[model samples]
Target: MEQAFAQNLMQAAQAVEQQVDDELNRLEKLTESDIEKMRNQRLETMKQEHKKRQEWLANEKLTESDIEKMRNQRLETMKQEHKKRQEWLANGHGEYEDLPSEKELFDITKKSERIVCHFYRESTMRCKIVDKHLEALARKHIEAKFVKLSVDRAPFITERLNIKTLPTIALLIDNIVKDKIIGFTDLGNHDDFSTDVLEWRLGVGGVIDYKGDLSSPPDNNERKKKITVFGKKPKTIRNGMGGDDDDDDNDAED
Candidate 1:
């Protein structure tokens, strides 16, 4: 039994040695063509990998170019809008003007694309209130030209427009009367109306471009009414302080 076990171990050792000798002989017999084929296969694989990398890089560059194009277009549009606003400021559009004569009013209306002309009387208090709001609006809305024509100075234009009211805001486009605000009636009929209300009213006339939402209430939420005396403040009024009675009083006061 010991002799048989020793014989089996010797056979296994011989088998392993023969397998190694066979692998070494096979490697020694390799032809130049076989080695060249292996090199070519590796080179082909590297070329394929390089082509894929180049394609990915090209796609990335195209995406970056598209983004840059959009960015430049947006910048150009913003620059054009700014230039237009500056031109408007240079052409007497930013502030309110007081036209002295009917000819001046006509000339301004003809030159300006849009105009908000307030016909006022010096003696009228309500007209003074409108002046305060319009003066502020003129500075803010530079797109439209704001001007005031005193009924005393521009008598011919006043009669032609049939403006009987003390403070009538005429919205004109290319010298044609598009609309009119016949006093505080269109402006919530109150003395203490906010600038936002007046702005909304003018926006309705399409003379000025108002930024606020027309569907919503005025932006100034506080102080709907001005306190006349140190006594108790009046109740919050929505549509106007007084009814027809207040309007009659306003007419007499005007």
Candidate 2:
């Protein structure tokens, strides 16, 4: 009986030691799994932090090219505005004026980019007609200063210009005479001419493109009709006379 009891006690002790060993193994496994999960979470957080920083940098950064393009665009805008202001100030800095003094005429030429001056006589009907056209043009082309000085009032300028004609329209650029709108023929007869005739004459000054249609009499249409000039095809824009190439040597000969 003593020997049987001693064997049973030894078996019980062995079983207890095995149970403790199994528990220790389970605890080791759990600790390892927990440590792996923590490491993975830390790695994921690092990746997320890196991605967020990259996005912030992209949104906030401006490249050299971007800065240069913005600067150029603003500079161009400022240049255009400055050019326009200079022109406006050159044009009496206001609306068209019947220049009160001859000095004002000289000042206008000195200041403006373009000059369209009408040498008018109060009693002359043709001068009156030209005045109306000039007034309308002044409002349209602000880049050019339009002046109306009475020939009787501004005798020195009239004599200097040698403007003997009753109504003379002069277009000057950079203080030099470019073209003179000569007779009443290009403009209709007597006081009947319209603003369009003046616009047509000023086309050479780069103000407008004359479409060869004048506000003249209905009979003038015959001059503008589809004509074969120089035995060639007609074009889109025309000489003031006709839509065809009127100035072509062959057409002029015809």
Candidate 3:
């Protein structure tokens, strides 16, 4: 009986040791799995942060390129403006050798002779076209003097004339502005432009007579005729009535 009891106690001790060994193995597996899960989570977070940084760098590069492009464009525009200014200054500061001054312009009008003034922003294609017409008119009317002025060089004259558009023409007689026409026109349209200039000369009444053989003789009967008989007055005639009597009255008043 003593031996049997001792054997049973030994068997109980072996069973308890086996149970403790199994529990320790299960705990080791759980701890390894948890550690692996934590490592995977940390790696994923690092990848996400790296991706975000790369995207931010790409956006910053794009923004910098856009800013550089705008700066280049503005610099190019400034260069063009400077070139234009230099050209204007090189051309005698906007005054021609025989060109009349503001006071001289007024004197030309007072003399009853018509003064043709051409205002240009620059020597552009449109200005060249207008200049050709002016040369033709100078040949056609010896009594009229053709004057050229550049707006870029003569800001005071441009401002005094209230010239807002490029390639403007003004007809002055006896220092009074009789008519002004604006814009460029085809050579085919020169007849209309010439007509405006002629009308301004006629506003002087008796100061300068048309000397061209092509000019018709002035008839007192024609002078009594209505303006409708001679087609419509040009839209450029802002002031003045179209009659020799009106001119006489104005002269008398002066």
Q: What overall lDDT goes with each candidate model?
A: 0.73, 0.63, 0.53
Better model by lDDT, 2 or 3?
2
RMSD of each: 20.9, 23.2, 28.6
**Predicted candidate 2 versus true structure: per-residue lDDT over 1-254, tens digit per residue:** 99999999999999999999998997677777787998999999999999999988985797889879989999999999898877687456436688786778777766776777776778877677777777887777676778877777877765555566667666666666655554464454455656765675565444333455433323344465333221222232222111122222211000
Decreasing lDDT order of the candidates: 1, 2, 3
**Candidate 1 weakest lDDT stretch, 10 residues:** 237-246
Error of 3 at 202 (Å): 9.3
Ranking by TM-score, best first?
1, 2, 3
Q: Where does candidate 3 stray beyond 4 Å?
A: 1-112, 185-232, 235-254
> Could you give candidate 3's per-residue lDDT for residues 108-224 as a string of tens digits?
444334566777745456666667656665554445556676666666665655666656666666555565555532112343345434433333332234543222212323444
Q: Per-residue lDDT for 180 in model 2? A: 54
lDDT of 1 by residue, 1-254 (tens): 99999999999999999999998998789899988998999999999999999999977777777989989999999999999898788779989898877678767765678888988888999988999999999999988999998888976666666667778878776566766677676666678988888887677567788776544436433434332211222121122101111122224234
Q: After superposition, how far is residue 236 of candidate 3 from its true place, in Å?
A: 7.0
TM-score of 3: 0.37
Cα deviation at 18, candidate 3, in Å, is 99
Q: For candidate 3, which ten residues in a row score worst on lDDT?
A: 245-254
Clashing pairs in 3: 109-173, 109-174, 109-175, 110-174, 110-175
